[model samples]
Target: MKTIAINGSPRKGWNTHILVEEALKGAASKGSDTELVNLYDLNFKGCISCFECKRRGGKSFGRCAAGDDLKPVLDRIHTCDALIIGSPIYISEVTAAVRALFERLTFQYITYSKDRKTFFTRRVPTALIYTMNISEPAIESMGYAEKFKFYEDRFNQIIGPAKTLVSTETWQTTDYSKYEMTMFDGEARKKRREEIFPQDKRKAFELGAGLV
Candidate 1:
């Protein structure tokens, strides 16, 4: 099996990278070939909404018309067995770079009939990983949960439902002394770090390994 993991985080070796790396490691251990693509390192433009793809009909038909870095990535995605996308939430939404990548990737697959309804019947299996500073409950309370659902529905429309994994408030500690007493409870934070994050990371890894 071959799996492709897309890291949408701007930082190269940070939280998103670590999660994707762990997932890829899991896939590799299972004898699956895996590739990781960092969007920040690529040169890609957002979709132009030119509707040229729908007009054409071939392997290139479903590809973005814009000549940018996303074209090759799109081609790779078409051939991969399983896809994992990881992004950091910013301002209650996906980062601009990641959002643009999604736009370019998904917009070309849409087809509309006389009824003016868009449909994407050709689909693939995909997984979504979102890392944010806010806790899951707080994110939900702030209406950020819908952002994931929106992406889920969009991906489902083109590629089936994605199994989403979320990592909340993952930040490295620089100075422990500066934090408040309640916040600086080292034991509690350590427990969460060593226990919870590893479990989540392992889950992501297993998901990659199980890809068909």
Candidate 2:
């Protein structure tokens, strides 16, 4: 079995990356070949509106025709057994690189046939790892989780169920002493990091292994 993980964070060693790697570890432990792809390290663009993938009765059907770095990843995903995607919430949604990859990759599998109600026909099991600055309690009040829920639901509609592991109140900076914020409590942040982060990592690991 082959499982692929994508890191959407620009920083390779950040919380999102750590969680993705943990997921990969769990998948590897399950005797699956795992690969972690960092989108920040790749040069690619989102769907270019070429409409090549959407054309019917053509060679481009069910495939993204974009000739960029993303094409290779999408090609691999077309045949992979499992997929894990990790992203940090930036301005209330996934980062640009991830969104770009999502569009390019998902749009290819989108189907509008009369017999098909869902977007995609692929049956791959997927897991989403999201890291955010807010706590779980604030998710509903701010309605910030709705966007992610939409994506998750859409993924389920397209492929199989899309499981998500969310880490809140993430460690944002390497050195908190270098920044200034009166409202910030460094001790609480450290406390959460020490107390809760490991559990989240374990959750991610389980998410990966379970899919395999």
Q: lDDT for each of the candidates?
A: 0.77, 0.87
- lDDT per residue (tens digit) for residues 105-177 in model 2: 7777777778765435568999999999898999888887787788898788776789888999988875677
Which candidate ranks first by TM-score, i.e. highest?
A: 2
Least accurate 10 contiguous residues by lDDT in model 1: 115-124
TM of each candidate vs. truth: 0.84, 0.94
Q: Model 2: what TM-score?
A: 0.94
Model 1, position 83: C-alpha lDDT score: 81
lDDT accuracy of residue 39 in candidate 1? 89
Compose the digit string of candidate 1's lDDT tens values, residues 88-203. 88877888888998888788767776764443454567888888867668977888778788898888777665778888756645445567645555565556667778877988
C-alpha positional error of residue 161 in candidate 2 after TM-score superposition, expressed in Å: 1.4
List residue ranges in candidate 2 displaced over 4 A: 117-120
